[model samples]
Target: MKQAKRKKLKKTHAPTLWIGLFMMGLLVVLAVLAPVICPYDPLEQNLAEFLKAPGAKHLFGTDQLGRDLFTRTLYAARTDLWIMVMAEIAPFIIGISLGMAAGYFGGAIDWLVGMASDTFIAFPFYLLVIVIAFASGAGSHGIFITYLLVGWLIYCKVARGQSAALKNSEWIAAAKILGYSNIRILFCELLPNIIPQAIVLLMTDMVGLLVIIVTLGYLGIGISPPTPDWGTMISEGQTFMTSAWWLSVLPGMFVVYTGVALSFIGDGLADRFR
Candidate 1:
């Protein structure tokens, strides 16, 4: 019975995992190779070709500024994905470490961590992000600062729960009895166990983060001009939605595609880890 159950689980998750990996990997490769393969400079403009529809010359058509939409889209992928990964690094590390410490030490440490996370959770997530971003000023700096302030809360919560549960386990008590230092037990024992769940959360969290970035760009507080962000592109194209719908639609589609890919990854990982 157990063997059959294990096999069923494997069959269900394995395909989803592989499909997501393939889709995401293809996008990454294309973005990385954008400079080499792109026919035109993403930022270059030609008044003559402005608003030209998709054709042999311009595969995805030209925007209002006469820049190649295809090129800009690729470049946008590069910018957004890079920012997404970089923005998460600090929060991931700090959140996991703090969560582990709080759970392992308990008492004062746990209380403080709980208070901080709860405080952040009290407000609407996007509201906090927008306010912070507006105050911090535009571009990547604002985005990073906004994330740093709030992004760690989810990770901290997840890690804290896992650590707390594990702390009372027999193995944890055995480690204590065996003279393992608190630091060593927290990092060496607890971290390895908790990291898998955190990674699963990371996949889904990235999708949300990407959406936030696009929203910021749409609102004129992200990436800035000439940077080829999807949100900014959508905002710019909205004026011509009737005449040249591709401008807004194409970028929006890519955002959905990327989000779907990440969602698959998160779901698959969750199933696998379970």
Candidate 2:
């Protein structure tokens, strides 16, 4: 029965995972090669060509500033994707470590983790992020700081639960019996098990984080001008919705595309883990 289930899983895993990886990989490649493939500089404006509709020359049309929307969108991918990946690194490490420690130690450490996470959880997540980002001042710095403050709570909670459950398992008990130090046991035993779930969550969390980043940019508080963020592009394009709809619509579509790709990866990982 287990062998059959394993085979079934192996069969299903490749399609979803590969589709997602291909989509995401394509975006990353385009973003990386934006300078080489893009016909115009993302920031360079041409008054004569301003608001040109999508043509052979400008695949995504031009914005009001006459900059190539296609170029800016590609470059924006570079910025947004970089932030999406970079922003998570610190939180991932901190959240997993703290969560593991809390679950493994389960005394004052647990209490503190519980208190901190609960306190943060009390506020609405996006609301809290917006408030923090606004207070921190609009830019990448604010976004990073906002996430650093609140992003880890979900990971911490997930890790804590998994760790708490595993702490009493045979392997953990055996580690203790073998005279392994707490640190070694936590990293070697607990981490290996907990990390799978964390990775699954990481894939999903990135989607939400990307939304937040785009939202902040829309609100005039993210990435800043000349950076060509999707949110900003959407916001800017909204003004010309009737005349030049592609300005907003194309970027928005890209956002949806990226989100879908990430969701596929998360779903695939979840199935694999299960």
Candidate 3:
């Protein structure tokens, strides 16, 4: 039966997931080593080499300012990875805690959390992110603030449902009878059960965050000048797209690559649970 199950999983799961995991791992390593391995300062400019096409000295070519696109692209990965981590962490913690509490307790707490989550959800998702970014002022700080303010709803909703379902389980009753503190029961028992599903959701949400981050950058409401952001790069590259397709295409590809990798990981996790 064990061998059969393994075979079943292998047959059912797409190869894209493994490929995505591999790509994601590679990107992480690249992001980590970017500063050390990058060929040039992403911000350094040489008008002499401006708009040069891919060659031995410069791989992804040069942007309008003659900054090496290769270097900028590598560094952009680091910026994006940092943003993704910072933006996701707060939401994960706060959302899970509120969700667990609301689900387990299910009274005023539930009503309050439900209302807040509903309010956030009612707004068009990307529009809310854009509004928050513009209102808070554009940059990493603004994006982080926006994500913390609203990103929790997705995780909270998922965790709430899971917690509600599990709250009355036999083991929960046993834990209560044994005098487990509410805090201990919620954190130790309920949290552990909800995490697997939450993780899948987290991976998917990261992709959305990446898109929002890029979109903000593209719209000039995100990472500021001299910072190598994929969206910013794409925005800057658009004017020269006819003459230098690589300018926009290469950085945009990085966004696509990361998104695809994350999507595969999320899909893989969902499939595993199924």
Each model's backbone clash number: 0, 0, 0
lDDT of 1 by residue, 103-154 (tens): 8889999999999998878989888888888888878988898899889998
Please give, for residues 1-274, the per-residue lDDT of candidate 2 as tens digits.
9999989879978688778999999999999999999878888889999899999988888999899999999999999999999999999999999999999899999999999998878988778777877787777888888789888988999889999999999988998999999999999999999999899999999999999999999999888897889999999999999999999999999999999999899888888788
Q: What's the lDDT for candidate 2?
A: 0.91
Where does model 2 exceed 4 Å of error?
1-9
Superior candidate under lDDT, 2 versus 3: 2
Clash-forming residue pairs, model 1: none
Candidate number with the higher lDDT (1 or 2): 1
TM-score of every model versus the real structure = 0.96, 0.96, 0.94
True lDDT of residue 50, candidate 3 = 80
Global lDDT of each model? Answer: 0.92, 0.91, 0.90
The lDDT leader among the candidates is: 1
